[model samples]
Target chain A: MSTPLPDPSSEQLPFEPRRPVADADRQRQSWNAIEARLQEAPVKKLPIAGWGRWWWAAAAVLLLLAAGAWWWQGRSGAGSATSYDLAYKTISTRFGEKRRILLPDSSVVILNSNSELKLPADWLLDTLRQVWLRGEAYFEISKSKQPGVDYFLVHTDRLDVKVLGTKFNVNAYTAQTTVALKEGRVELLYSQRPGRSAAGLRVHSMKPGDVVTVDEGPVLTPMLATAPPDVMADWTSNEYHFDYTSLAEIGRMIEQRYGYEMEFETAALADRTMSGHLRADNLDQLLQALQITLNIKIEKKDQLLKVSVP
Target chain B: MTTGAMPSPDLQNAWDRVLAGHADGLRQIHEALYASMIDYACRLLQDEMLAEDAIQDVFVKAWQLRAQIGEVQSVRAYFFIMLRRHVLNVLRSRQSRRRQQQQWQQQVELDPVFSAEDIRVQAEHTRQQQQKIATAVNELPARQREVIWLKYYAGMEYQQIAAVMEINYQSVVNLAFKATQYLRKRLSG
Candidate 1:
């Protein structure tokens, strides 16, 4: 068989016409198709009369006013609103205090110090199976056999975690959201809010042994770490363990944990790694041990703790 | 076609005619705009089924707010905007759902053959030679594509295209010129 040759003048070829689309005929077909599909789609009768119209108008007016206010405030400023429904629950723990929460679904949440989580009471609803958390939390999501219904979602400000009958730990505080999968597979979505529309929302997914962070914007860079089981659970049990945690990150963690301020003196020392386990109550002793082992001096002035090489 | 039946002109004039509290004017607006709105939505979403769904939503929403819709400057633009918003909402929710199940690595690789640049280049050449110029029209740069769609498909003016695309009049002129030039080159070649 002879191969069909490419047309050399294909680029020069004028537009080709097959048949005209009769708008009237196509419209009739489209109307029929729309009717059939509408029958299948869930239709929520939005009553425009009575209180509903007023409510909607009020909402629209409020939104317009808010938009006007936002423009006046500064068009480019970050604006966020937090709304919670009746089916959701929010738990916040102060610094140095750990809290345990049992969700409306069978999932268990162990919120570490200075952490908070908002989760829906029922995961069976098609629209409301998601959860949002800040700081750190260990989740043991209950398993469900319903094919597509079994999903546990955790949303931080920047990261979104999706799990199907798995255990994972998410440490997503102010700047970063990190996920460590201990069992099964967990999907992590790192979203960067693009400054420009062309960039859109940059998203990345992560799997087991993958720790992904969604920082302030839409860049998702992953770091590899051993999938240690129940590392987050230890925090709730008054134990903190770090396997090669960086000095800078450790310093930040210390600040968050104790509600004290800490800073590294030099950039080189910030990269220094530490590995140890210490009771949550013995942070002072742990800091002393770190100073001795790392050959550094720890200075305290009011609320600030400074670490420096002597 | 009965003589006693309400004349099309009378029916058209019966904007205030309320049939069981439903405005006849609104019904006529939906009837006039529904098909075009669906076509526009389908082009934006590139999904026939989704476009149909969005049109249904638009009709429901229009019916519910029939009173307020009278204030709309252009019913066509209003309906198209509604459909556009609905399609974007659907796309965003779908993206969120897809992000949950799919691996990040698998999803990041841009489709080699169907990249935006390739489509734009191919469209530029093919659009010039076509009799039915609309299909090739969608291949232009987003601004030009939108301008042509509004100008030819919707029978809108340059000023209207400027308003719809949220661009200045000069920019619209430049885009249309550039688009026409590409078409001319392809046709003359």
Candidate 2:
């Protein structure tokens, strides 16, 4: 007789309680250190000491210097029509339209459809070039001959893009803020307002071919990695290309694109992440591709598709 | 379902101590509740690290927002709900990354031999039988798999599972029964 085959249930299972590893203790220590640092850091308080007065004076002097530097930089350029309060004026564009704005400091901005730009009425000659944007725009900043006075800045709802002399496109929609550096160098700050509190803004400098998305919160931090250049500008070309997108987010996108409701049968299945792109016109074709590619099943009842594991 | 209300006084005292920033009191609460929290997170994410991280973040956030942490209807339930939201956020974020074509997938797939009923079986014979049962369980439909996990792993009552899953309790019971029957057939085959 042949030897009896081992039952699958009779095999030694890998279920065992994991003991606390040495790394866990190290993690605990690191957490404690961080807590301690937070506790020790300066807390917000009313300043009352003589040294506090000195600190206030020092702060005032620094502010004046910064303002003076800004004014000086704004005035350094010649042959350009300069307005004292150019930034206070607001410029906007409607859908299916583009507007070219010539700032007094000689910086050029090409605003795309459904875009808005708000700048100061009088752009101080010696100060930083700053402007607010709501939609997509391409910036071509002119270089200043004077040192320390040539930096150009674009402010979005969540980020500040600074350029010395470069071309960049910023798509700062409320849902997603993206900065793509086409050439030269650009510095992205994490605020509409800069040079207030250091903690108020997080900054990142980008080189050409770099694209950053501010996805997490109000404070715009650059994404850890740049997306592929081909798919990064897909929105402009009406081509939707997602490298790896979750089903839940895809559900949201589907809702936005076709105005349909989609839900997952299980949270686990909802949590299932899929990566693919479809050029189809409707939801059924996209779901068909998704189902075949990801080994997922979609049950369509009326308008909703309940996505689940096959 | 049992309301399962514990003495509210101990929870209130614990809350006071936590509000006072006593580390030991916080640790005591953690010790009292960590198992259930970890289990809920594990059921949600199917990853131990992610579950642990969720628990740790819940504790840190609770401490940070101690002022806002209102009176305990049930501290355990409150803590579980909070941790569940955190786990959901993690899941949502992981899903977003997955949408972007990222390769990191948290392993949540259960072994095939561990049936929902087998989880309740404490005997050595059933422990030996777990592998076959788990395999059979894995072969069940997606809805059946979820029903099994919610019942056994999270220890949620049928009604509680219904509420959390947004499904009828009858459907949950039917799914569980079907899942068990499928496992039995697969094992016998």
Candidate 3:
């Protein structure tokens, strides 16, 4: 009595119509068990190759800049950092650019976009391994150089993070400074200058996974390390994470990471937030991704960008 | 430029978080899609345990290589593709090992999860037609079964199937069309 099946071109499939309800429960249990095992595994970090040879040149440049700044401060950080800009170098990445430097002591540093690291010329000559950082950088410092146990010190504007040798990330933008220790040990020393005594520089030891933030004020005060280390998030890899973050903040990030000046018509629009993971090869690609996904409009005029809400 | 919006996981927020490599996202994706992937794997491997193993292997590899792989055009399809490769490799290795040991037995039978009985009810005549269509499909070759599942069960477009199968666009359409013609021939015969 049946003539024939409907034409397949219509995209009709007579496959199993009914799905078992009990299978859902079984699936949930299986997945839960797997998730538990995954949770027990150690956190994974990206593998960094050797880039130690070029650090001295970059550190030297940065040290010169730091010395110039220190001298301008009129002997404020006096007797602490002497002439070390000869072999030392300074390395920096402009907006949308990142650089990697290899320290004289063989420590590896990755300077984030719009970040700078300054090293003195006499870096290996002195007892202290010192560097000045602005913006963000991740360091894999070598603790020992065969015979001698080298001391490492990273001075941001507000605080100084010292470690013999360890892996950590430092974020020292204008707003605040944060240090996250991924491995080994680090000591945070707040630098109290101006009218405050040097004793104000309290030393706080940090363990792995420990993160501390130093706020910007007339005095440097350490905030409680409550929140997890979002500062240590890898931006260079594959994905960008934003959690209800404001458009203004996102714009600033894009500006830093892609060298784009993003503008909004209204302050409210600029403050609008979106949460998603964005993947793009470059700044233009990232902007296109955001626009395509968020149902927003973006127009680029020369070097300026105007993002409009739909 | 796979800008064409592909299907996202039901949990969009969780998917985005997974893309970001957050711990929460990892758990969410595992919970949300693991069962589906395992079921899909089971169709190929037949044994529930082996299917589960294959899926776990794929998921672990996916996680480890997530950063390097970058963003996926379609998360579901990507996972499915990974699972397919893993199961096939496992089958191949087992076959070779069995060959070396000379203990080879019968090939594993893929359970016929897709059947005419799954179609929605209609008139008596339509029901018969649906059953005939389902039977024809179940009888298709291994490659045809794959394209059928990807197109119908996974709801992947022709382009997606082509990309996942590593074939050209025309090849994908031709495969599907050929499968359809084969199904018609079987039903009519």
Best by lDDT: 3
Between the candidate structures 1 and 2, which one is better when assessed by lDDT?
Answer: 2
- lDDT tens readout by residue for model 2, B1-189: 121223446656787787887765565566555655555555456544445556766777777777777565556546766776677677665555344444345643322223333344445646546666666666777668767765665455677666655568898889889988887778787
- Please write out the lDDT profile of model 3 over residues A1-310, one tens digit for every residue: 3122223345332111232212554555555545555644544644323454355456555654555365133222211111212344445565655555666566887777667677753543323578888778889899664335356888776777888788888888664778888788889887565433586657889888787887767777777553344434455453577778887887877765556688897777787778866655456566766776666777776556788886
Best prediction by TM-score: 3
lDDT value, candidate 3, whole model: 0.64
Residue A61 lDDT, candidate 2, scale 0-100: 46
lDDT of 1 at A227: 53
For model 1 the local lDDT of residue A121 reads 28
Ranking by lDDT: 3, 2, 1
Clashing pairs in 1: A14-B129, A15-B129, A15-B130, A192-A217, A192-A218
**Per-residue lDDT of candidate 2, residues A170-202 (tens digit):** 876454777887667988877523333456656
Q: How big is the positional error of residue B46 in model 1, measured in Å on the Cα after superposition?
A: 50
lDDT of 1 by residue, A133-161 (tens): 76788888887533566776776655567
Cα lDDT tens digits, model 3, B1-189, are 121122365445655676687757766666666655665676676544456556656666666666776767766667767777777776775565445445546574443355554443344648678777777777787677778777766567898788777779898888899987997678777
Model 1 lDDT per residue over B47-149, tens place? 4435555676766665555466554455455565666667667666555544544513222211101122212333454533343344345456666776665
User: Where does candidate 1 stray beyond 4 Å?
Assistant: A1-88, A121-127, A145-148, A190-207, A215-218, A221-234, A264-272, A277-282, A308-310, B1-189
List the candidate 2 regions with Cα displacement exceeding 4 Å. Answer: A1-310, B1-25, B39-46, B66-69, B101-120, B141-150, B159-189
